[model samples]
Target: MSDNPAADAVLNLVKQQHDVLEKMLNNVSQAGEAQRKAAMGSLERFLSAHEAAEEAYLEQATKNLENMQGWVEKLTELDYTSSDFVTRFGEFQKELINHTQTEIQHTIPKALRDMTQAQIDLVQSAFERVSETAEPVE
Candidate 1:
C-alpha cells in the first residue's frame, strides 16, 4: 500500500499509546503496590492523551462519513472509568488499530488525498503533543 505519511503517523501515535497501556497492565500485574500504582498512573495519562488526539483527528474527521458514525458512537459509549478500564482499554486500542488501518488503507487516501501539507502537519503536531507531558495514569 502506498504510504500516507500523515495517516501512518497517526497510526503510530495510537500504537504508541496502546504499547504504553500494555506495559502499564503488565507492570501492574508483576509489581508491588507502589509500582502498580505508579504504572496505573502512567497508563491514565497515556490513555487520556491518546484519546484526545484520536478524537481531534480520527473521530472528528470520520464522524460525517457513511458507515463510520458507528465508531464515533462507540467511542462515546466506551467507559474509561470502570474498574475494568485497563482490559477495556486494550479492547478499545484494538478497535483504534482497526480504525487506523482502515483510514490508512482506504479512508485516508480517499478523504485526505488532496489535503494540504499544512493540514497533515496540524494532525501530526496534535498527536506529537500528546507524546510530551500527557498526564500520568492517575
Candidate 2:
C-alpha cells in the first residue's frame, strides 16, 4: 500500500478487481459445457468494463494489460466443448495470470508513486463507476 491514502484506496480496489477476475477465470475453467458459456460471458463482460476503466483513468500510470481482444474473439468462435477451445482457453488463463501478476508486483505501485492524490481519487471513482454501470457485452 502507498503512503497516500487515495492511492492506497485505488490499489485496494484494483486488487479486488484482480481477485474477482481470477475467480471468474477459474469458474470458466471448471465449468461444464452447459455452464461454460455463461461463465465466459460474465468474465468477458467484466473484463471489458475493467479494461475500459483502466484505459480511461490508469493507462497513463501503468502499462495497460496486453490486449486480449483477439483471444476473446477466438474463444467466441470455438465450441466450448472442443479440445481446441480448451487449449486456447488455457493459454488465455496463463496470459491473464502473468498480466495480473505484473500489475500487482510492479505497474500499480509505480503508477501510484507517480500520481498525485487527486489523480488517484479520479482513478478510484472511475473504477467504481464503471464497475457499477458497465453494460454487458453482446
Candidate 2, residues 6-112, lDDT tens digits: the string is 88778788887888888888988999989899989899888888887777766642355545767788899999988888899999998888887877788778877
lDDT of each: 0.55, 0.79
TM agreement with the true structure for every prediction: 0.53, 0.87
Model 1: how far residue 92 lies from native, Å: 8.7
Worst 10 residues of 2 by lDDT: 58-67
Per-residue lDDT of candidate 1, residues 1-138 (tens digit): 336767566556655655555555565445554454555556555656655665665544445333334443453454434445445545645554565566555654554455576776776787688776665432
Which candidate has the top score in lDDT? Answer: 2
Backbone collisions counted per model:
6, 0
Which candidate gets the maximum TM-score versus the true structure? 2
lDDT of 2 at 41: 87
lDDT of 1 at 100: 50
